[model samples]
Target: MLSEESSTSKENIGLTSSETSTKPRSNLMASVELTGFADNGAGTISATLGNKANKDIAKTVITQERTTDGVWTCKIDGSQAAKYKEKFNPTGCVKK
Candidate 1:
């Protein structure tokens, strides 16, 4: 049984491991690759992003969107600074 917190978190994020099928959009021009993950899954990707000085300072579930072109784009949530973080900045999320 999922706890209330877990259930609410899932609802708020709106993503599950099983929902990995994605279709490319007509507008995207670039064609990259996720390397190991499903090539077509373009949606929310939740991951724990941390800071250098203090890991917990910016530690949060940073969600990136794998666009139709296969690039992981950052989606900012609240004031969490998920977009400005090092790993997600400049290059975007790499499935490591």
Candidate 2:
């Protein structure tokens, strides 16, 4: 037979240990998004990996010109194009 005080102390210790063992852990993921535009006609955006992990990715410039009736041509920097392609699809670009 156990005393009342001893039983209470044991229950408290068990509760504390159970709470500590059941503590939740954090899981993180990587993501990217386009935020907005910049001063020099460029797109501003952000990229994040985990909690408190963020970065100002880049500002891409968008250019458009009227080519024909109801038609327009758009262009982007070659370097920027390559970077985006590589980011989305690592397996080289194919031309048909």
* Clash numbers, per candidate: 0, 0
- The global Cα lDDT (0 to 1) of model 2 is 0.28
Worst 10 residues of 1 by lDDT: 24-33
lDDT of 2 by residue, 1-96 (tens): 111232322222231123324221222213323322223324322222233322221222333333324344444322432133324322332211
Q: For model 1, how does the per-residue alpha-carbon lDDT over 18-84 read when each residue is reduced to its tens digit?
A: 2232221211211111222334545554544342324332434445576767776664332444334
Pick by lDDT: which candidate is best?
1
Model 1 TM-score relative to the real fold: 0.29
Per-prediction CA RMSD (Å): 13.9, 21.7
> Clashing residue pairs, candidate 2?
none
Query: TM-score for all predictions?
Result: 0.29, 0.22
C-alpha lDDT values of all predictions: 0.36, 0.28
The C-alpha stretches of model 1 lying farther than 4 A from their native spots are 1-40, 49-59, 76-96
- Angstrom error of the Cα, residue 39, model 2: value is 27
